[model samples]
Target: MSHYHYSADQLSQKQAYKFLTGAIAPRPIAWISTHNLETRVTNLAPFSFFTILSSRIPLVMLSVNRRPDGTPKDTARNLLAAQETKNETARTAGVIHIVTPELLSAMNQTAASLSFTDSELELLPDELQLLQEKDAPLAVENAKIRFNVRPFQHQLLTDRSDLPMTDIFYLEVTDFYFDETVFDAKREYILTEKLAPVARLAGNDYSHLGLLETLRRPD
Candidate 1:
């Protein structure tokens, strides 16, 4: 077999990102929705660098890459603003949804950058354009799974020269909504196969579940 290996220092930031994402098999997508409650402006987007930080405390983490202009993404800013505000009703909160293969196209469209005053909700598909109700995490009644998160910690990563690259949000999951089809009330378990989550790959590719496997660990 042939091999291709290069030092991290040899690549530019863009090159490094490309190579890293290309090799990182399948990463789950966090279809994040940040809302300005007063104006009802939503910043909906998808991020792949997301993972569970803690299961006991119900925490999650997602890294938002900065723009070419060195500005933090809207999702990052909205969550930060939410943390600072005293008003609970008006505070902007992050509502994270699960992505299925069928929703990939609509998810991509939400990735388009809009002005601070503009909203990405305008571009969402008809089914997902419902209004977000107060004290609701699912956004809509039929949503499969959604996590209502509050950002408690943020880490700004920088390069060698101190140039900022991404903002890492350590979010505390406040609540979760699981539809009946994907959840077991008595067992308190999520049905993964029914959820049908989609994952992000390199470039413009995405993948769904295939070939279930089960390998029990040794006791």
Candidate 2:
């Protein structure tokens, strides 16, 4: 057996990001949709640095990196603004849609670089519908599973130099929407085969759910 190791401190930011993304296999994608309160413009983007933090409170975490200009990304900014504002109705809430293989193309479209005034939803195919939820941001119409989430907390990650690098958000799920085709109401389990989730790999690579396996825990 052979092993190669590199110190993170020695690697450039770009190199470190490349290596980390390559080494981390099959990361789930969070197709986040947020709305700007002032512009009334909707923003959609994909991030793989996402995971469920606490099931009890239905909390999910999303980590976003700052832009090269040292500014918060649109999604992070919108979420933060939503949290600070004490409006009778949430003016900047969002929805996190679960990405599936079928929606990969549409999801990728949302990732394109666009002006803050522009909307990525317009680039999507006509078949892909965007539906408005009363007070929340628009939701992907046919997404098999989606979470109506609002910003719960925001944390800024900084380097030793005290330079902010990443923004981490803890979101609270207010509601859940699941498609009947993928979820079993009586069994309370998702039909994995039907869901066909796509996972992010290194670079432009992505993977589909491969061989399914199960391991039972000892009672």
User: Highest TM-score: which candidate?
Assistant: 2
Clashing residue pairs in all predictions, respectively, total: 0, 0
Model 2 quality (TM-score): 0.96
Model 1: colliding residue pairs: none
How would you encode candidate 1's per-residue C-alpha lDDT over 82-138 as one tens digit per residue?
777744554227788888766777888988878878877778678754646575322
- In candidate 2, which residue ranges exceed 4 Å CA deviation? 86-92
Q: What's the TM-score of every candidate structure? A: 0.90, 0.96
Residue 156's C-alpha lDDT in candidate 2? 95
Q: Candidate 2, after superposition: displacement of residue 132 in Å? A: 0.9
lDDT of each: 0.79, 0.88
The residue pairs in collision within model 2 are none
